[model samples]
Target chain A: MPEAVRSALAIAGKDLRLEFRTRTGLLSAFVFAVLTLLVFNFSRDQSLISTTDLAPSALWITVAFGAVVAMNRAFIIEKEQGAIDALLLAPVPRGAIYWGKFLANLAFVGLVEALTLPLFVLFFNVPLGPALPGVVLTLVLATIGFVAVGTILSAMVVRTRFAELMLPVLILPFMVPPLIGAVQVTARLLGGRPLTEVLGWLRLLGTYDVVFVTLCTLAFSAVVDE
Target chain B: MPPEAPLLEARGITRAFGAQRALRGVDLRLGPGEAVAVAGPNGAGKTTLLRILAGLMRPTTGEVRLADGRTPRDPAARRRVGLLSHQSFLYDDLTARENLHFTGRLYGLGDLAARASRALEEAGLAARADDPVRQLSRGMLQRVAIARALLHEPDILLLDEPFTGLDVPSAARLRGFLAAQRAAGRGLVIVTHHLAEAWGFATHVGVLARGQWAQLGPRPASLEEFLAGYQELVDA
Candidate 1:
């Protein structure tokens, strides 16, 4: 791997290993995603719109909500354990820290997405075909977007009181455009509809990723500084 | 004599948060190996001034110049100008070694383990090097915090209440460490409201008041003179 990517993965890998060791944040997020999808199955009308019509929406809504939950606890280990200051004193670019965080968050939320994807097909019975790869692609791209904003916001809200409540309240509204965009593209992909139909939302999701990743990287030095 | 290159210098640095003025037109200089203690009452701009000097917060009105005659470039400068603040500035989840290695990576230090191991020793945390900071006692954690701060081998040291909550032994050891850093030709600035130890080891001292500096100079010609000046400020 390239040096930059190696560093990025190490950041992600370390967080994953820590989470695995502590079973602090990631486990709950995974269970929460699975349970959320189960609730969606019992509550929603499966017949009105082909579950496929809403499959993308259901999956991403699950992912988005789970992202908030996962992101809330993302820095808990660092903040509570006293590791944050250690990370800050290091000579790594603040952007590297942000990416490290983003990747960790991306892995966490991606695990939730991965778990729910099968259950998404099982419970909602969304039709799957060659579009399986497309759905996976959409999930990864949207994970990057989810993590970019969530990572920056998590760093801010974690230090404040009412962290758990504050994160979702702040994140869910901002999550809409991309959440809708992810769902729309997924629906089109699963339905085997023309890419042209979903391209608008696809572009919207792409744009959200670019703008947020850039803004967060630039503003991150303030978040880490004392 | 000739201004001595002011190891770290700030010209007209000003920062205001909303309506409250944190710092206003503050200019200060530190020469090589000078340890300046910044003293002020609560609400004084001591913390704000240190933040600006550390390059964490950009000054609204002035510039911070390094002794090398250049703009404060990046984290490396901030790393070199170390501050021991109320905050530990560490990663709580990672063990001491993990924490140090992370920082070592940032400074591009080759042989991360060597740097980290040496720092752990310097902080007197070698025995507890593998323990998570959360599990360490306050004093041990303080030592770890010091090790983390010194991992990069900074040229200037800034301490903001470094002694807060430390036991006498820990503080004594810390005092020795700070003294050694000063002896090594690094500029050190410490800000504290506590008078007893604040004024003890420092060579040069500065008093900050109401968003401005009131006085700054060498150690009192006599210890009694330092107390009288500090007491006057406290009573004022």
Candidate 2:
């Protein structure tokens, strides 16, 4: 394996181990997501409004908010323990550090989304049989986009006095493009729209993921450099 | 004959934060088997200088180079230097052994488990290796921090107020450990306010005032003489 990949995996593994030990961040985000799904389920009557129509927006909103909660804790731990300095002092490349944190956050947010998916299906009463594959693809792409920007913004705000307040403010604006793309694609998949019809939204999501991931990776070194 | 390049050299380092200058053309040279103690008043740019030397921060104007002529900014050069700052740079949730192992992995060291175990023993924390860092006392934390810094066995060690929060016995143990490192020919730069303690170990001493080196040279013959000189320099 390449040194960069090895280093990244090491960091991701360490983060997962710590998370496994405490489960504080994961548990909080999971509970919040479940509650968000429940609130959406109870708000509307299924007879008047179709479950499919509401499922896309509800699922996306749950993911976006839950991701914010998870990413907010990503660098806060490092800053609190001064582990960021130790990381900086190491010979590892800055991009490795960013990717490591990105991978860990990706897994965390992905887990929350996965756990919430079953609840979403049960609450909305939507048949995800053939649409499951498309929904999974859309979720992965959208997650990459959400976590890419969320990871960088988390690092930026971790040192500030009002870090918790600052994360949503800094990330929500950049999040709009990806969130919109994700919702449209998800809605199309749930509605069983032809793939050709939703190709534009898929492209939008792909472009957003590629562009932001590259941009954030390049910009991370500057963010962490004192 | 030209002087051989020191193990580490800082040439004309100057740093400023907006209108305030923290380091003004500060220069230093460190070689193996030498221990330099840097003493300074508050806000004398001690921390800034150490950070620059460690390549954690860039100087406004200057450069740091390793003995092999690699710039401090180079990852290869950075790998050769160890730094222990005021912040322990430790993960409170992780055990001492785990923290050291984590650092070893970051450095890509082979045989990490054995190395971490050795470091744990060296720090006198072998019995508590599995305990989380947050559970440890300040002195124990400092000891673990030292272990973390030395885990990679870097050629030079840069320490900032390492004695802070250490109990008397811990402090003595640390001094002895550092002395051993020096004896083994590792370069050391220690920043402290405890003149007496510093004098006991330093072969050379420096004083900084207002972001400049007020006086830097060999250690004075006695603490009284060093104090008198330090007072006059700060006053002047």
DockQ of 1: 0.45
DockQ of 2: 0.80
> What is the per-residue lDDT of model 2 for residues B1-236, given as tens digits with 9 covering 90 to 100?
98755999999999999999999999999988889999989999999999999999999998999999987667767789999998899988889988898899889999999999998998889999999999999989998998999899998999999998888887888898888888898899999999776667788899999999998888778989778778789767
What Cα-based lDDT does every candidate model obtain? 0.76, 0.89
Residues A1-226 of candidate 2 have per-residue lDDT tens digits of 8777788888888888888788978999999999999999999888987888888999989998999988888898888757898888888888899999999999999999999999989988888887888888889988999899999999998889989889988998888888898888888888888667778888889999999999999999999887
Among the numbered candidates, top TM-score falls to 2
The candidate 1 chain B region of ten consecutive residues with least summed lDDT is: B70-79
Q: Can you write out model 1's per-residue Cα lDDT over A147-198, one digit (the tens) per residue?
A: 8988988888778878788888888877877777777788788878867777
TM for chain B in all models? 0.91, 0.97
RMSD of each: 3.2, 1.4
Alpha carbon lDDT of residue A53, candidate 1?
66
